[model samples]
Target chain A: MSIFINKQTRVLVQGITGKQGSFHTAQMLEYGTNIIAGVSPGKGGQNVEGVPVYDTVFAAIEEETVDASILFIPAPFARDAAFEALDAGVKLIVLIPEHIPLQDAMDIMAYAQKQNAVIVGPNTFGLVSSGSSKIGIMPNRYFVPGPVGIVSRSGTLCYEIVGHLTGNDIGTTTVVGLGGDRVVGLNFIDVLRRFEEDPETKTVILVGEIGGSSEEEAATFISSSMKKPVIAYLAGRSAPPGKRMGHAGAIIERGRGTFESKVKALNAAGVEVAGLPNEVPAMIKKILS
Target chain B: MKLYEYLGKKLFHRYDIPVPHSKIVESPEEAAEAAAELGDVVIKSQVLSGKRGKAGGIAFASNPGEARKEAERILNMRLNDLTVEKLLVEEKLQIEQELYLALTVDGALRCPVVLASLDGGMDVEEVAEGRMIKWPIDVSIGLQDYMTREICRRMGVSGALQKEFIKLLPKLYKMFRELDAELAEINPLALTPDGLVAADAKVTIDDDALYRHPQLPRVKEKTDLELKAEELDIAYVELDGNIAVMANGAGITMATLDMVQHYGGAAANFLDFGGGASVERTAQALELLLGTNPKVLLINIFGGITRCDIVAEGFVKVRESKGIDLPVSFRLVGTKEAEGRAILEKVGIKTFNSMDEAVRHAVDLTEAS
Candidate 1:
């Protein structure tokens, strides 16, 4: 009853022999994710945690059916890995590396669109559909299956807020980290529309930040056609202007992507916007009741 | 990551882009000497931030004496919070038209966008009111000649002028891609008597891609604390406060800063170790945080790819090596959470899983101090 993934969603790990890829591959396995294959160019005949490793995604797809892929490739090689996955007919991709070159990200985005596939991040923690399955690197225990579908542009901030929501017994159907980059694969609008269509997701939580206009676009979408109750929280209210606050996309430029502008947009769209992350649960509770 | 005007011009020259002759100078005497060689110069205060024209950072000097006087005035001036330490003395152009040209990523379009306008020599923000022509380029095909011609024609360029833009747009796009630059800009591509030349250059290379570009000049625009953090490979932004804040991700760090301010506490800096920080890297981050001289150190870790036990070890390593004696609050969660808490507790460091509780404790401790 989740949006992107569940128990039946078979997955593969790209760059699975790397340190991070190996560690998280084991973690995802322990979380009961339906991992089917692993890809490492040189170590083709090897096996990582009982999953067969192949030289390429196409070679891996030759033996088994993989519905999604989690990429742990280095930033420089991430584009090629992504293109290979798309070319192999894998529709969903979770890119874990940060600091990917902007041009490569653009190319990946265009290529993914042409294939009608979904790429989650160029810099992200990935996604988890509560107890059903997890494709990202987020700590899965903090989440539980429920009606609230979460979408965010951040990683740890999403974790902290989800911790608060789950602590208060407000579980989630799916939580998506839209990534913390300038040109991400999927944005708030795309995730929001998916959540709106999912029957299990009655409420949605949109976590946005300063720097880009994705939140503004989400506000426009919510105001016009959204039917589900949504609560929004934006970070970087006190962040200094112009300086990039850690994230490449999390910056204020030419007086745009300010906290004031995003808040105003969300509020004008008849959406309840929490000034602080702690206020999210209360706002969500009030709306659902 | 942001190159000064002189440096940007050097890059422009290397890429065969036409630029006005320029030389960088620190002292007024040096400026005078350079201006004498290139007469009728423009004395531009070399600061990273834009809008130098409005800040009076750009001055026209017809003579070497005027250039010297202008440099003296500007070298001691502060524009947009950045002090002018250097000047770019360049030959002034006999301009006929000013056009804007930039290659940057368009977040909304999810592609590289080329922006052009007939009106330039002004901040693009000032003229974004429907006067600019924007073309989002498909990265696979790149900035095609037809797209360039269409953008130039829309910007009111025609005939020879349109052809010039078509030739230059791809070069700009190439510079942006080759350098891994976030922005490759010519604010005023002046149509001078000598033909179209870049009057001003604004190039910003991605800090993450600096490893790929060893030839690019490393500008020291950061403060002492920021520079130290950069050495440790941590993202740090200095702020005016007494409480130093650290986190695993940007969004959480920002939220932590906001929460500290909400509780009447100011954060001294914003630092993120990113994901999957090793023990030594974490220890280095902690050591760098202490360099800020804060009243209290607030460490917030929400481990996803980053394990909490490793972060806990980083704290202990810093405490043992650097002899940290300041009041510190720790918020640790996810992957090996209990083990992380136990490690911190063994070292007499109390840990809280709740971010709110940790922030509140840190603010209270700092306020008491």
Candidate 2:
């Protein structure tokens, strides 16, 4: 069983009429995600890939049980879609829009907290719970059902690392992409806490990058409360300061959020950190053995 | 999207935030004219980067002649690899105190934050001396006057100064919101005989939110390579290393750079062909990376929204079109890996399933060459 989603998890698609929304909706259906309904403001009576569409999240929830909602709205309108999902009582919201205004991200964060909900990302690839269910854009073939839990700040980086693990016969219970935006909805600490509590997830693998203090914060939490053995792989060691490396959050500023700092913090917490993604599987095998 | 100092000050003036009268000048003669118009002015080199004062990009002029000389020297200065071509001539203020104030989003907190310090005109990172007071602003309610006063009190600000801070905080917060700025800072809000004035301005408009502000104060010029990358919708940054690294996602791209460096190879550039890029767009991304002329090219793609076969198609296209002879190594996994590898194999371009093998091979090639 996964921490957030599973086979029984009924999902709804927000902005389901848009190109990405429709495309991923079909993909999720193909993966057997229990998609209950869809939302696309004016396209209420229509259906996307056999999933019923409603005008608003509130209207969609009135008819079908939507435990989670995947938002494919544009960056400018992503905040409104998140609020709509929260107001409609959808507990888990996965935001797919990148380049969301910082102010809007902050508001979304505050509102999500107030509603006691989980918002994955404003620039994420979403999450998948291996063979049983998936709610994101990640290719399902790379993931297999197992005890290792993966949480990362990137999509392709997560894919690469998970592929290595799966190739080594290490499957994952769930893989979560926390997004690469500066102001993301959830941090490493939040996911780590959940992973620590999941009995099915025996060990955790954190895929981090340079930029924010989330990795440091996660390390702090692991040193204090985490009992599960965790392996970490941090990126951007050679990245120069003051230059944003692709991701808005992947920059070292004022000597803070450097690769050395993150590695030092993680190592201090007794978490074995790998220098590269491919080294993770061997380290994990060593830890398990 | 960092606004020049003169432009940032213009916005401060528009918002009724007190700032010295300033004029943008190109040459030393224009700077002298502007300095003469304003008495005993300061000539500041206009560059996109910060720490200008420490970099000698900021200088004071006692008179118009001195201003002209300062402009000549500053115009030829380079700070953080950016040449200063323009100068901001402004009337110098009689400062009684220099206070630090800024409004920016704290990524970890996931909220807007207001930072004020008694010590000013220095890097905020050096504010570990206990003079800095930070208050996280709730974006729902914004930076209220009460919150500003509370922050001022926490920063040991009192009397007329506290009142001025209370009045100024809202305007600064408004600028941060209305401009869609990622960072809005006044390094030294000087308190002088006239009033509280912004001694320096730094406003970085969110590149994604730039569409909202069409009539920006000035558009910072982009290099030809940067413009080309923008046209192709790929995140590209040119570096001074020997290995060209390309990946499908930002995190993976950065990790690839780090791995290349870890294996004793310096990456020449950082390029991420963001998710779901089409076959044609992927080809264009590869072509753009080829323009950097690195010793070795390393392509690591773990397809999610992006398809691995599409990336393979791009490699094939580049080889067929430009006929690349440089040492190239790639790792393809996830989303049609077999098909992607077959495409590469058909083109006689060997592919690796392991990122480590590919990175090590590329780094070894760079060393061998």
Candidate 3:
């Protein structure tokens, strides 16, 4: 019923031996994610959090039933790990690493797309299907099963949206953190399209920041194919030009990625735009009503 | 992560790229000496971030005395919040044509993207306004020899200069790769009255990639404000806004900062205390933030592995010890959330379960302030 992830998805963890990989793996497992197996070179034959570890993604695929793979590998090795999972027929993957060298990130994403795979983030904070599959590092307690689908560039802000939705008795069907990295594997438009098609996702909440034309692109897409009501909010409106906000990708450089331009673009596209984060829930409520 | 122009040019020169004769000056005497080294020199303020020229960081002096004055002025000034601790004085370039060339990772395509423009000597921003010769190169293929050649040819580089262009591209590309640079730019990659000389160079190394290349560049703690924040060892990213945020850990702190922006408020800084922030540390962190003269403060802490009691203890100490000199709002969740709230409430501040409420209150308070 939902897009990308739901109760049925069984995920695997790549690079499960590293500190971040193992820590998040344990957290996801504890959050009730079906982390079927873990993969790390030379860490095979060991068990973490009751999940079997394998040497490579291919090995992990063979040993366990996996619907998706979340990459926690270092940037240098992320390219090969992603390709390995894709080659082994991992249909869906999410990359949680940031600052991936641009070249490697592109080749793998292109390669994965050619293989008909869906990649979430290169510098992303994974996606979650409330109470079903927990990926990345989003707080589990903050999410509840609901009809709204949420996508954001900022992971921390997503909690605010989720908390808003939760406060209003609106729970997300799936919340996706696209990350604020400049060169990410997926953008808001990509995830929005998926949510648009999903039967369970009745409405969508998009959280964008003042950087890049990704929001503009998403707005254009929303004006056309987006059948569901989409309420969007963009952060950093007053951010000075060329001042990089907390996120790497959320910088206003040479007037390309400005909050004003994006707001105009989104407003022009017939999408109800919340001027600020606090107004998001009210806007969404207005759209639904 | 951003390299000063002089340092970037030094790396450029090491790769055999021709540049104006240059030396960095730490003192006004050295500045005069550097200007003396070149009959006519360009005194450029050494700041880490971009748009130095727009910030009046670059000044040209025809005489050593003028250059010394320019250097002296710059060294004491702050450009775009970056202090000019040094000046890069270089031989004045008789630039005939200023071309633009940069090798950067394209986010959309997830590959190395090369942008080239023929219009030279003007701000690259102006050329960016015009159409650019954009080529997206797959990393597996790397920078192809033919494309680099084609790019040079398109930019009207020819003869010995074309060959030099050919040589320059690959070497620069190699250096870019070797350094794990996120961005490498040769603005005014020029055909001078002399030859192909890089008028200016800028390179930003990926922080994540720094572990592999230890000597590349340490994350230099810049800015007196940032340095002061560093005294408390808080992860702080200063913003142009009037609202300050102090939270534990990079991730949550970033979230709180973003939330501020989301709710139509700007965060003055991104300060992360990491996991398990003690009361002493929290007070010091608060003290550092107080220096920012924030209209209001929003402190969001999620204590899981780091206990809420510890965070509560920190909050109480910051208030009891520092006497709450600033207008602030706080949110404490997970692991003794109740206790965290109780401690804050006793100090006349309230905690919220919803970030929406905390952010709204903080934004309104700051706006009112």
Candidate 4:
């Protein structure tokens, strides 16, 4: 079974009526997610793609048995939506907004943890639980049900890896995006631990990039307790120091954050590291074979 | 999402925390007036970004003439990549104890952390090595009484300042919450040799939360450059490159930039129509891209929300509409991808599906030129 999302996970869209919310909700419905309800302040009585909408998250929660909430709300209201979801005791929250204020993000993170709620992003594309359930905005065609569990920081890189794997007939169980924000809710280790315990997940593919000590922390976690064979790829190998390659979190300042350091750490920890995105599926195949 | 230092100080003043007496001036006339108000003032250029000191964004003026010159220099100049459109003239404080105080998001710990140090001004980051007073403020419950008390004890701000500091901490937290600020900082809280006073203040508000803030002008030119071309409407951040990129949607633009770097080519600029861009907007984009004077152009689009033919038509019209004639490369996918290609193919625009091929062609143009 997929860890965070599955067919059993009844979901609610916090911003069901907005342009992004409506589009993704329709996509999730097409992908077979149990979208139980939606919440928007003014458009409560309206329906979005056959799903009921409520004025408040608390109101929506009272009416439906939803396990998780996917927030497609804009950045400014991200904290409010997350807090509302947490107050309703949602087990998982998928936030698909970028450029959230650092203070608001920090508060939301603290609030989510206090309420025993786990959030996926403040700048993320969401997650796809193979063929079972989908949350966020990741392209679904790239995935197929398999033993490999994928966790990545980049949204499109996850798609790039899946494109590489899908062509080779390999698939993923659950692809989790920790988001490419500097201060995201979930980290690599957090998703990895969940992957480790899932019986359906025998192998893992991690799509990491240059920046932060996240990859190092993941390497340490894998070295200590992980049993699954994991093949991973870290982007920005050619990226020079003191250059930010678009994503705010992808910058390598001084000698602290670089592609080489991450690759070296993962290799030392027994993770079969793909030198590039194209090399990932082949490495995973070689290890599994 | 950053508010100016003066705004932060205004909030501080409302909270009863002492901030330096300051005035924000727009013109040279106003600059002189502000300096006169302060008497012995420090004329500081007010740009949004940091590293102002390095770029001559901060200067002192002894009199009105000097202040006007400094303001004139600052207003015309870019400081930390942001234009210094305004200057802050503040009554200089008597130097005494300088300390750093900030409440920010600590990524690793996954919490709201309060950082304070006895040292401030130059090299504060150096002194923040290991023993700085750090208070882990809870996000939902906010800064508890005990957390602030412990922070006060470590800061050595006890006695009369304890109650004042306690009141200030909550107010800071409140301001952070109410404004949706990313950072609320008071660096070198200059005590004027008197023991306590905030010399400088900084605030950064979240831009995404602007739905409620109607008066908040998007500082970037949300200009009516729209009539010119779709390319012009797109926010362009010029980079050191010969290959100009025109991409639909922000994410794809980012990917195109990465792919450009991967193929050993630097991106000229990042231009995005966001989503659902039209023909007029596309031509506008082309005109803007051509302004960079790049050797080649890469137009990457996955037309899910946008039509390929519409974008292609815009490129064709760029020469006629904006008088931009440039060698261009493109990769069009998703809706009407074939039709879009036919239009571009007839016009001699280079086309490729693989990002690898597109980047290679663009890099070749740069090398040949």
Candidate 5:
């Protein structure tokens, strides 16, 4: 029992003929994701790693049941691919492209909302439901079935933290990447709501970074409503203002989204904020004990 | 990519928004010549930063001679670390009223928002909430006629003035949409004796969207090392600290920096080579990090798609190519970690599996130094 995706969830791949698409498709298949069809515009009638390909998402959906769609299209073409999937009624979209235009991201988020769908990232590493299904680019060995639900904005940071957890004999139920862009699809609150409802998830770990009011907003939700204990680790405390720190959304603008503000919010909400990445697994152990 | 004032006005003028007649000048002679033609002009230093007025980057000249002096003074001035090299000499308008109009993305609303305030000529962030009207624009429908009319009415704008606003707002919204701008601002949309004119223009295009809008000017406001990092396609930001930090992801890199500070060590710079970084790219990133000449170097990599062995080989390659004497704390984990550690070991470089241990070691080295 996992949130968003599992072994029974049939998936579709957009831009499946591309280098990243083909590689990840094989990786997803290896991890036992139920991939049914692929979309590559002109590469219909072809197969990638035994999954059938179609010219369009509509064409692919016509033949196979695509519960979710993972896009490997580049940033410029990501919007169109996402729209194609949404128009075909694919509810869960994993957008795996970086440097997507901010306008395109806004439109994608708005359109996805209108269609009652959820998009994981436009600049993301996607999500994995730990031993059940892997839709993202995270290494499979780092994740195993466990009680902790992990949601994060940064991909590699999430992986590194997950490695700490798995290495310490802690497993996760699902790991969702919210993307490291100014505008992303699913945020901390969105994932936290799911984690709170999941019986398998007894504790939640939020991996947030500087920039944007998402973490502060998530803290508000957690304090008012959440029953399960949550731990948070925020990055970019040492970053200077007005400089973009790798991620487009990871900058402190106009004194908002600073590390102090986020840590204050999370702490005020009764969530333990880890000072270092390695401190997380120990904190989780204490909470569960 | 924040455009200079002159460039923003150029975009505004191209999109049919009304602006003061202006000529961009580089030298004091050109400023005098432009002022003579325009009459009673304002000499504005064309820079990417705001608060130009506070920085003494703006001056009014009643005559051409004054304009030349003002230009000469401004040209030598550095506003917010940016030297003023160009001036936008424009006709100073007789202002009847001032208003604020801007179209910017609202992260919370997840869409473009039009911010209108009758109280202008100051930072909108400082403006009282009640005085400002924020209308979130749905990207699907865009800025509609009704929305603009409502905004104008709320600001007590009517008659011919309302008509001017009705005509102007859409054009501004069009420029915002077409240019893929993060912010399109008119801080003082002055009601002049001639007509409504933009007193100042602030336009910032999305850096990610710059590839599509190649015609736009690229402002160089970065340090030499930052520019070099840009050319090498590595994410790097220099800080005034001792330990130089490098990692695989933006979050991890930032976290590495935070940890260095947490353990009472200041980080010299932030460098992330991004995921699946090739050995060559890794070597280049390492070389760039070393260029900072920090007291200690901390490399934290949790390879997922980015292999540990690849990153290790990059360290070995850099060590073989250029001799390194600095204390280096390298943490390698995930995907072929043993092989990566083995490669580093061959070069007498010790690798740690724990990020905390590696960061503490680096901080200790910096402190010891």
Candidate 6:
């Protein structure tokens, strides 16, 4: 069984009328995600991919149960959309937009915690329960239903690794994109905990990059608690110090989140860290065998 | 977007946080004039980087002539690769005690954290962790009065000084929240004979939130290529290497850079065209990559939302228009891979579906060159 989402999970699309929202809504629908309703303040009474749209999340939830909400709202309006979804009692939020204000992200996370909900990203590609459901903007072609549970911070990098895995006849139980924001909803440990509990997930593949203590923290969690074998592929080892390598969170700051530090931590935790993406599938094969 | 000391102080003053009397001057004459009016001034190089004090970017001036001389020396100085164009000429304060206070977002906690230290003026990072008291502020509740008081008490601060800190901490928190600041810092919250005065300010507003605060100056601490990339809406970082690397996502782009290095080649720069890049945008990104004039260009696209065909079309467009001179290694996969590969093939360019093969080829080309 997959974690977080499956075929029966009811999803709500926020800002459904927007370009990204409409496009991904069709993609998610095509992937057989149970999209119950859409929310676009003024564009109520419309249907996107045969799903009904409402003025507010409250109005949408009044008709059907929405287990999760995927937002495609712009950076500035993300806070209000997320708050509305939380207030409407939606437990899971998948924020797709990048460059969301740091303050808004913090406030959203704090609010989500208070409401007993989970947020996926402010700059994330969302998540997928392979073969069962898709709630993110990942190109559906690469993922397949299998034993490995994938958790990553980068969308394309995850897709790249998944492509290699799928090419080698391996599949995934679930792929969780934790986002590349400095302040995001869920982290490595949070997703790893779920991966550990999932019966279908025999092995966990962590796709980490340079930045933050998340990888190191994940390593600590894996060593102490995780029963499943974990393999990792960390990016940006060649990154220069003090330079933000594209992602807001992907930077070496105060010598804290260096590549060496993360690699050492993961190695100490007994996780085989792949030097390259293509090397991961073999590592996973060796462990599973 | 790290604001200069002068700008940070301006924001501090606006927020009613007590700061030393200061004037920003671009020239030595202006520095001398401001010092003559202010009396016993400190000429500080207005730069964005830290450790400027150690770089001789800071100097004390007891009189106008000394201020002018110091300003001249500083204005000509380059601290941390940044040229000192402006100087903050301010009245020097007699420090009774030095304390550190800052409000920054704690990534792990996903909340704003207030860090207070009795030891100040020196690097807070270098200070013992025991000396610094960190309190994570609940974003929903914000910075409470009791939290600040508790922090002061934990740091052994009491009496009139505690009261001043109690009043000042909230203002700093407020500034941090309202300005959408990533970090609002006072390195040396000095206690002078008069009262508590903020001797230094290092405020960095979130670049994402810059749109909301239009009044704040957009500091250009980037290279010309970086600035150009910003204008082109491409995420780019200049590096000191020979191979120019281009990729679709930030994570993958970094991985591509790592791969290049792993294969014994250094990347000239990091450029991410971002997701769902159109044919034109891809062509533009190619042009920007070419502008770096690297020995080789490595284009790695794990096409998901970003279509391989579109990226291929961009390559063809650039090849047809400007004519690419340097060797290019293209790795195309994911959606419409065949179509993208065919497009590149029609233009007499072969593509590698495997990232390893493509990266190795790029590195080999760089070595051969």
Q: Which structure among the candidates has the greatest lDDT?
A: 6
**lDDT string, candidate 5, B158-277, tens digits:** 788888888999999999989999999999999987778999998989988889987888987788999999998889899999898899899999998888888999999989999888
How do the residues A1-289 of candidate 6 rate in per-residue lDDT, one tens digit apiece?
A: 9999999999999999889999999999988899999999999999998989999999998899999999999899999999999998999999999999999999999999999999999789999999989999999877799899999999999998999999999999999999999999999999999999988899999999998999999999999999899999999899998899888999998887999999999999989899899998898898778
Please tell me the TM-score of chain B in candidate 4 relative to the true structure's chain B.
Answer: 0.78
On a 0 to 1 TM-score scale, where does candidate 1 land against the true structure?
0.96
| Candidate lDDT values, in order | 0.89, 0.88, 0.77, 0.76, 0.91, 0.92
So what's the TM-score on candidate 4? Answer: 0.82
Docking class of 2: high
Could you tell me the lDDT of residue B194 within candidate 1? 72
lDDT of 2 by residue, A1-289 (tens): 7888999999999999999999999999988899989999889999999999999998988898889999999988988999999988889999988888877888899998889999899789999998888888888677789889999998888888888888899999989999989988878888899999988998999999998799999999999999999989988888999778988888898888999999999999999899777788898888777
lDDT of 5 at A269: 99
Mind giving the per-residue lDDT tens digits that candidate 2 earns over B287-333?
Answer: 88888788898998877777888888878888898988899998887
Evaluated on chain B only, what are the TM-scores of all the candidate structures, in order? Answer: 0.93, 0.95, 0.76, 0.78, 0.97, 0.99
| Residue pairs with backbone atoms closer than 3 Å in model 6 (clashes) | none
Q: Decide which is better by DockQ, 3 or 4.
A: 4
TM-score of each: 0.96, 0.97, 0.85, 0.82, 0.97, 0.99
Instruction: Provide the DockQ value for model 2.
Output: 0.82
What is the full ranking by lDDT, best candidate first? 6, 5, 1, 2, 3, 4
C-alpha lDDT of residue B142 in model 5: 90
**Per-residue lDDT for B162 in model 4?**
71
The list of candidate 2 runs beyond 4 A from truth reads: none
Candidate 5, clashing residue pairs? none
Superior candidate under DockQ, 1 versus 3: 1
After aligning candidate 4 to the native by TM-score, how far in Å is the CA of A23 from where it should be?
3.7
Candidate 5, A1-289: lDDT as tens digits:
7899999999998989999899989989988899999999889999999989999998987898889999898889989989999988999999999989999999998899999999898789999999999998999888899999999999999988898899899999999999988888888888999999999998999999999999999999999989999999999888899989999889998888999999999999999999888889999999878
Summarize candidate 1's per-residue lDDT along A1-289 as a digit string, tens digits: 8888999999999999999899889989988899999999989999999999999999999999999999999998998999999999999999999988887888899999899999999788899999989998888688888889999999999988998898899999999999888988888888999999999998999998998888888999999979998888899999988788988888898889999999999999888888778888888788778
Which order, best to worst by DockQ? 6, 5, 2, 1, 4, 3
Show the colliding residue pairs in model 1: none
